[model samples]
Each structure stands twice: as structure tokens, then as C-alpha cells.
Target: MDAGALAAALAAARRRTLSLFDALAAAGYDDPARLPRLSIVNPPLWELGHAAWFAEWFVLREATGSSPGEAGGASLLAQGDALFDSGRVAHAARWTLGLQPEVIKSYCGAVLKAILARLSHAPDDDAALYPYRLALAHEDMHGEALLYTLQTLGAAAPVEEDVADWPAAAGEIAFAGGAFQRGGDQSRGFVFDNEKTAALLTVAPLTIDAGLVSNAAYLRFVQDGGYDDPGHWSGAGRHWLAQQGRQAPRYWRRAGDDWTGIRFGRQVALDPAAPVRHVTLHEAEAWCRWAGRRLPREEEWEFAAHSGHPGFAWGQLWEWTASPFLPYPGFTPDRYREYSAPWFGSRQTLRGASFATAPRLRSPRYRNFFTPERDDIYAGFRSCAL
Candidate 1:
């Protein structure tokens, strides 16, 4: 990309970073004293601080001094690392923490101001450039996580003033598989270290749904007793389904004979016509099997995603893929060792974006992962013919 282009993209990204935090502040962190069960969505205060601190750590610290605020900000981030870092704690503990909301918000505000000041100097300096890119992208991801967290916590739907109409569903496009490029091409501007390289993989002929699996389609599975059939689930998935007594999608509530789902903090009629959100890999796979279809593999998912419209609604919800979340050939961890290495082989990968995904954060090569048993994520899947 040209210098002028880089400057423009970075400027656009910076604006998005601020907007993301503003949205978080509006999400209203629940009163800690009156909190509910533990979950991955922490109070908005904690989220705000983490977002700012991540930017500060990567951008400001490297640009000015390694020490956060001349005294090392690690203390502020220490106790909460296991709680908020995606790589550490279980997703369910976010709601159970005892953090001081006011302090977190103030600290986050301070860090944001500092980082902005540092950005004014050298917007494209490599040290400033790379980490700034990482920080913005990182915040973009957390923005999506924060959205899912809101749904998990039953917080109010994000107050989107000009809520763009959901894209007219892109009818599924047909892809005849052959040799295809998988993963990121570094020539593009900033991508996560995890998505930095490309690999060649051959794909078999298959047909993927024109669009993501719809809630209406998933409801058919529910109506058909998809959740109760062991034949429909993997062994571990079946075990987990039984353990959780899951009878429907994670947030759905049965009222009399109808189904309602929580959206943006309000319970509404489950839109059967809309794509299903918040499903697990097990549920996705089971649904596919019951329908005589199979989940698309990771390569197929990427091929379809990139093949589709460039700016599709990918950031709306994490789309499930048939592939496990493992490193590409010869994958190397950049400075952020904690980003992707630890979770390798342990997590199944998801592609596409969700409602909470930051506009700046996604690409064809982005990889999202969760354990097979995890059902609380902002995830759903698409299917392909055998």
C-alpha cells in the first residue's frame, strides 16, 4: 500500500477505535454489587480498560517508553489478565469478577488520551506502525467479543443510531474447488500475526449454502429433536449437551409454545428468517448431519467468504467452519506469543464476523477458534453437500 493510502487507512482505523470505546461506554456495565453468574462478558468498565491498555501497550509503550505511564502499567493489567485475556480464563468467568468499575473507566480514558497524543507524531513509523495496527485490530476484535458478551450478560443491545439495514442476504455462490490459496497475504495492510502468511491447499468439489444457516433452518433441527439425538452429535458434544441440559440454542427461551430470543437486551420473537446466532460447532454439525449435509471445511469456508462480496456482513456473527483451529504450515508467532500459539489444536475455528465485530478487524484470512464444546460464543454455521 502507498504511504498516502496507509495514512488514510490508519486514520480511518483510529476513528473506529474511538467509536468502539464510545459504544462500549454506552453498553452500561452492570452494577457489580448486583451482578449475575460468571461469563466471558465482563463489566463494560473492565472491557474499556483492557481495550485502552492493549492499545497503550502495543503503540504508546513502544513509541515513547516500554514502561506504561513511566511506572509500568502491568499492575493494572496483571490480576485481570487471566480474567479478560482470551488466551487464559474460561469464557464463563467474565461476569463473576469484583473489579471497581469507576477506576477502570478512568484509567481507560487516561490511556486512550495518551495513545492518541503519541499517534499524532509518526503515524507511519514502523514501531508506531506495526503495534498501532495490532492495537487497533485487537480492539476491533474485543469490540466484537464485547457484543457477544452483552448478549451473554443480557445487557442492552448496543445503541446503534443509524442501524444499517442488514445486508440483503447474498444468495450462496457456487465454488468448484481446485488448488486455492488459504490464509493471509502480508502484502495487504495490517493483519494479525496469526493471519500473516498464505498456504496452498487443494479442495474437493462441494456445494455450500448460498448464505449462512438461517434461524428458520436451525429451528427445523430443533423441531426434529436434533438436540436429543446422539447420532447427531459428536461424543464430546453429546456429553456436553447432556451436561448443560441444552434443549435449544443457548439464549432461546421457551414461553408457552413459542420461542423468544434475547436481542440487544430485549427479548423478542426469534426471527426464524434471520441467520441463527450463538450456536456451537456440535450443534452446527448435528444440524448438518440431520439434514444430510456437512459443515464446510475451513478452506471451503474461506474460499466462499473471500469469493463473496468484499464487504459482506461477515462482521455480524462468527460463522462456524468444519475445520479445527490449527496453525497454517510453518506458522510462526510474532511478538504477541499469547495471541494464537497456546490455543492451537485445542480449539475449532470459526470464520466470518458477528454484530459486535469491529469494522476494521476482519479479512478472508482471519481465524477465530473455540473448543468444540463451547456453545456460548457468537457463532453459527453454514452447510455443504457431501
Candidate 2:
């Protein structure tokens, strides 16, 4: 993106950051002393400051030859590196950091002001604007995480735009696949390090569902004893099922005959037309097994998304792929060393966007990932014929 587009996107992302922080504060996450310590979540005050610090680190510091290694400049926040550098700070340690909400809020404003000031003068070239783009994407990513955190915490949630891309999983689409480009191009600009390794891969012709599996369909699996049967589950699925002790999707509850899902903090009837969300890869796998189908390999998913199938739909929720989160052949770490390298082989790749995802971040090439056991994310799946 050019300077103007980057500036506008950055500003919009910062506004979203502040709004999520406000919602967190209103829900008492600003003081997390009473909250249970979950390995999956972050402290609200730390996340607020860390988001700002990352932008400053990327746009204001690294862009100026101050890498994370070399001594560059002092942070606007006193002891900021000690406070906000995620690599330096451990997750459990964040709770004991003794940060003040008012102070972190001030730091957030200051960092954005500096970030905009820097972006105003940067050259419009892709090389020059890469850091700004990274910062924008990073904050946008965190904004989605914060929304899900609110949902996990049962706090107030953001007002989302309608994400109904289609009425149902409009049957299946057959793709006679051959060579497919599996990753992003540098020319496209702002490609993530993980997605930058381009490869023309040959994939078998596959048939995949035109739309995501709906809540109604998944409920049928639950009612049919899919979870209890264990025969439909993989070993990992069984382990996760036993660990979670779950019979339905993470947020689901049944009242008499009707199934309701808890979204954000409110419980509402499950929408038959809407994609099933907050489901783990294990659950998705079990459902696929029950239906005599399989999760689409990421290649098939990429192919199908680009095939221009009029009935195909996505972006209502993140869709799981059968592929594991492995690096492409020529993969290398980007400036942010920990972003993709650390979790390789351990996480599952999710595609598409969710209602919580920012519109600017929505792209078929964007690879979302998480541990297979995580049902806290807004995720679902569509199946492919075995």
C-alpha cells in the first residue's frame, strides 16, 4: 500500500485497538486479579501496551536501523522494553508486572502519535513501507484476538457487521486441480514471512463443499452421539475430547430441544444458517469422520477460493484445513522472529476470516493458525470428499 492508504489503515486499526481496550476495561479485565489464569489468554493491560509498543518497535525503531538486538532508542514509556517486549516478557509474568491502566492507555496514545508522524514522511515504495504494513497487520491481528478474549471472558463484545456470505453449505464443487501457486508473491507487497515462500505445487483433483458446515449440521453430529462414540474420533481428537469433557461446541448449550451458543457474553439460539464456530480441529475432524468426509487440504482450499465458484462462501468464520502449519520449502524468519517459526509443525493452519477479523486483513493467502485444541477462536470447517 502507498503512504496514504497505510496511514488511513493504521489510524483505523488504532481506533479499533482503543475501542477493544475500552471494552476490556469496562468488563474489569483492566484489573485481572479476580480472573482465572488461563494459558491461552493474555493480561488486558499488558496487551494494550504491547500493541502500541510493537508499532513503535517496527515503524519507529526497526525502520530506523534499530533491530530488536542492537541498542536503538529509549521507549516513550519508562521501562517500556522491560514491560512491553513480548519476547522478553513471559506470559504468566504479565499479570505480576504492576502496570497501571491509566499509564498504559497514555502510552498507547503516545505510540500511535509517533507512528503516524513517522509514516507521514516514509517513501511510498514497498521496501520503505514494509514495517508500517507489518505494524498494521500485527495490530489488526491482535484486535481479533482481543475480541475473542472478550468472548472467552464473557465481557462486552464489539458490534460486528453481518458475515453471512451464503445461506448454506451449497453442496460441493469439484476442482480438476493440477499446478497451483501455494503462497504469496513479493510483488503483491507486505507478504508475511510464512507465506512469502512461493511454490507451484501439483495437487490431486478434489471435491470440496461450496460453503462452510453450518451450526445446524454440527448439532446433528452432537445429537447423533458423535462425541461419545469415540469411533469417529482420531487419537488426538479423543485425547482433546477427554481433556475438554465436551459434548457440543465450546459455547453451546441445549435448553430442551433448542441449542444456544454463547457469543461474547450473551446466549442466543444457534443460527441454522450460520457456520458452526468456536470448534476445535479435533471436533471438526470428528464431524468430518462422522459425515464420511475430510478437511480440505490447504491447497484445495486455496484452489477453490480462487475458482470463482458462485456458490462457494467463506470469511464468516475461519475455516480449518487438513494441512499442518509447516513452512514452505524456502521458508525463513522475518524481522519478527517468533511470529511463525516457533509454532511450526505444532499448529494447524486456518483459512478465511471471521466476523471479528478486520476487513483489511481478510485475504485467502493470509494463514491463520492455532493449536488444534483451541476452541476459543471463532473457527469452523468445510469438508472434502474422501
Candidate 3:
């Protein structure tokens, strides 16, 4: 995109983020006590500051070298590197940081203003636009992170005012899988570094569930003691289960024979037809085993998504696949080096988008990754024929 367009996009993204911060502050989520020291949940105040600091570090400092700092060459925030640099700041230490919401808000505003001013005079070339787009995408990701963080804290779900009704039922879709191109097209727009180097891969014939596994379906696994049955789980999954003492999906509670889940801080009966969510890869794997099915490989999920086959539905929740996160063939890191390289092998791959995902980020080839044990994100699974 050109400089003008990039600036506008950045402005819109900042607005969305600031609005979320406003809501979080109103709900007292900015308080450290409200957000625990979980690896997945960043303190609300720290998250806001980090977003701003990142923008300044990339767009204004690294790209333009005109940002406010020592000799006007470093972060505008004096202690930004110490407090907001995620690479340097430990997850558990975020809670102990003395960050205030109002101060973080000011930092965000100042950083955004500086970026906009720089964009006005910047060239429309790749060098100038890359960091701007990168910052925007990074903030967009953090917006989704904030949503999941809210879910993790049992806070009210974000209001989806623009979301349309999704098709509720779509059975398994069959595919005569063959050689298919995987990853993304960088020329299309701003593609993440991980999605670069798109390559072709051969896939075998498979039938994948059109819709996500539902609460009723997963409940069957729970009733059959899938959690307790060691045969259904991997050794690592069993270890995680024992460590966490998890009985069901996070936020799930049993009342006698029925199940209820906490949605937006309200206890609601499990919707049998609704897609089961907040399940880890381990839990999804166990449910698939109990049901005599298996999670689709990442390639198969991408094929189904691109095929446009009838009864094939997605974008409800981030669907876990039986694939580990890895670099594509000839993979090269983009300008934002830290985005994908560090988490390559340790995280599992999730395909499609969740309801909280930004519409622009929801693409068939867009790959999301998380650790196998993370269940706080809005994640679910669909079964494939074994």
C-alpha cells in the first residue's frame, strides 16, 4: 500500500486497540490483580505500552531514526526497552511492573502521532512502508491477544457488532487431495514472514468435518472418560493433564449431569450445537481418538478451506491441526525478525480464524500457532477420517 493508505490503516488499527483498552480499563482489567501471571495473558497495562513501544521502535526509530530518545535514536519511552520489550520482559514479571493505564495510553497516543507524521513525508516504497505495515499488523495481532486475554480472565466477550451469522451445519467435505500450494502470496498485500516462501505439497485423499466439533459431540468424549483413559492421550498430553488437573475444556463446569461454560463472566448452559471451543490440541486429540477419528493435517485443512466445497465451514474458531509449526521451504525472515523464527518447532499449527480474529487476517493459508498445552485461546478442532 501507499504511504497515505498505510497511515489510514494504522490510524484505524490504533483506534480499535485504544477502544479495547478503554473497555478493559472500564472493567478494571488494568489492575494487576485481575490479570494473573499466566504465560498467555500479558498484563493489560504492559500490553498497551508494548504495542506503542513496538510502533515507535520500528516505524519512528528504526525506519526513520527521528523518534524521541537518547540522541533521538532510541525509544520515546525512557524505560521502554526494560518494560515493554517482550523479548526482554519475562511473562511473570509483567505483573510486577509499575505501569499505569493512563501513562500507557499517553505513550500509545504519542507513538501513533509520531508515526502518522513520519508517514506524511515518507516515500511509498517497500523500505518506507514495510515497517509501517508491520507495526499495524503487530498491533492487530495484539488486539486479538487482548480478546483472548479477556476470555482467559472470564471477562465479558467482546461485542461483535459486524459479525454476520455463520452457517451452523456443514457436514464433512470430501477432497481428492493432490499437489496444492501452501502458505500465502506476498504480492497480495502484507504477508507475515512465516507465511512467506509458499510451496507445493502433495496431499492424500481425506474427508474433513465441515463444521467444528460441537459441545454435544465433545461431551460424549468426556462422558466416556476420555480424559482419564490413558490410551486416548499422548504421553505429553497426559503429563499436561496431570499438571493442570484439567477435567474438561477450560471454563467448563459440570452441574450434576449437564455442563455449563463461563461466557463473558456469565454462566451459560453448553449449547449443544455450538462449536466446542477453548480446547487444547491434547484435548482435541483425545476427543478425536475417543470418536475414532483424527485431527486433519495442516495441509488438509488448508485444502478444505480453499476448495470451497459444500458443507465446508470455518472461521468460527481457530481449528487445531495435527501439524507442528515449522518454516516453509526456503523460508526467509521478514523485516520483523522476531515474529516467527523463535516459535518454529515448539508450537502446534492452528488454521482458519476465530470469531475474535480481524477479518483481514482470516485467510485460508494464514497459519496461527500456539503451544500444545494452551487452552485459553478461542480454539477448537474438526475430525478427519483416519
Best candidate, lDDT-wise? 2
* Local lDDT at 129 for model 2: 88
- What is the C-alpha lDDT profile of model 2 across 1-386, one tens digit per residue? 78988889998998888888788888888886955689988987888889898888877777343245544577888988898888889888988999998898888888888888888888879888888999899999998888878889998765652233345566888888878787898775789988978888787888889888988889899989998999999999998888889999889988898988786787777788878889999999999999999999887888788667787788888999999999988898887878999999999999988878899888888899999999888898999999
Q: What is the lDDT of residue 191 in candidate 1?
A: 58
Ordered by lDDT, highest first, the candidates read 2, 3, 1
What C-alpha lDDT does candidate 2 achieve relative to the native structure?
0.85
In the order shown, what is each candidate's alpha-carbon RMSD? 4.6, 1.8, 3.0
Worst 10 residues of 1 by lDDT: 63-72
Q: Considering every candidate listed, which one attains the maximal TM-score?
A: 2
Candidate 3 lDDT over residue span 1-386, tens digit each: 78887888788888878777666777788898876678777877888899888888877777432123422366677787888877778888888888877778888889999889988999777766778878887898898888777666766644762233243464777788888788877664677878878888788899888899988888888888888999999989999999988878988999998999887667887888888888999999988888889999898898888876767888999999999999988898765667898899999999989887777567898889999988888898999988
Which RMSD does model 1 reach against the true structure?
4.6
Would you list the rank order by TM-score, best first?
Answer: 2, 3, 1
Distance from true location, Cα of 238 in model 3, Å: 1.6
Which has the higher lDDT value, candidate number 1 or candidate number 2?
Answer: 2
Model 3 Cα displacement at 374 (Å)?
0.7
Error of 1 at 369 (Å): 1.2
lDDT of each: 0.66, 0.85, 0.81
Error of 3 at 177 (Å): 1.3
